[model samples]
Target: MTTNNGRAFTAPQLEGAVWKKSSYSGDSQGQCVEVAALTFAPFAGMRAIRDSKNPDGPALVFPESSITGFLADLADGKFGN
Candidate 1:
């Protein structure tokens, strides 16, 4: 995922995306992040969430199916946090 200027961080390469820390991620050692899908590229409909501190770091892109499932699980409290 590393590019010459920096890592291109393409949508497909974000499965292992590293996230930045958040105050809400307290004691998580920066294990969480805040990401949004950039609207200017073909990456639309694709997610690009990443750690806020490392703006250039990897991102997390979840497919529609996967994201939907995750949301359903959230509603059902599958992981129990």
Candidate 2:
């Protein structure tokens, strides 16, 4: 029952999903993105990301594990801030 395929899902498909923005974004005029963990069937264990300023816009969905690795890389400064 695993759905870790590498694909992106649309934001419209994520209706009712509870999206959250990072606290670090903090009043940056909506320049940050928001993330949500899909809890429902067919999409559970997946993560969705979207622009805070364009909630109605498209979203990039990924497997939870992928998002986890991405966060880890971010913490490791792999992208070099």
Candidate 3:
């Protein structure tokens, strides 16, 4: 099992995992990110993120709590323009 602390995963480690982009991701063909929920043991409740343009590339894994905090900060505009 991979650690849920932004560890990068190899191609073989992501086999069979389904990835989906954000709903707000427009069809501008610009930069977009994809996330896959880990539902199996040892990785369940976690999320794997990657660049939509690089399907076979590495993915950053994070725990569910971390994702929640990130979303909260995003909603709060913590990373301002």
Tell me, by TM-score, which candidate is best: 3
Give the Cα error of residue 25 in candidate 2, in Å. Answer: 1.5
List TM-scores for all candidates, in order: 0.50, 0.81, 0.85
Q: List residue ranges in candidate 1 displaced over 4 A.
A: 1-31
Q: lDDT per residue, candidate 2, 1-81, as tens digits?
A: 434454555666678899999899987675898999989877888888888998888777788888899889999999997
In terms of lDDT, the best-performing candidate is: 3
Model 1, span 1-81: residue lDDT tens: 222222246445554433334457776555567656434334445545566656656655554455567779999999997
lDDT of 3 by residue, 1-81 (tens): 649499998656877778899888888777899999988766778888999988889998899899999999999999996
What is the lDDT of every predicted structure here?
0.54, 0.81, 0.85
Off by over 4 Å in 3: 1-4
Q: For model 3, name the residue pairs that clash.
A: none
Task: State the TM-score for model 2.
Answer: 0.81
Q: Candidate 1: deviation at residue 48, Å?
A: 1.2
TM-score-superior candidate, 2 or 3: 3
Clashing pairs in 1: 3-7, 20-51, 35-49
Candidate 3, residue 28: CA error in Å? 3.8
Q: Candidate 2 at residue 62, lDDT?
A: 83
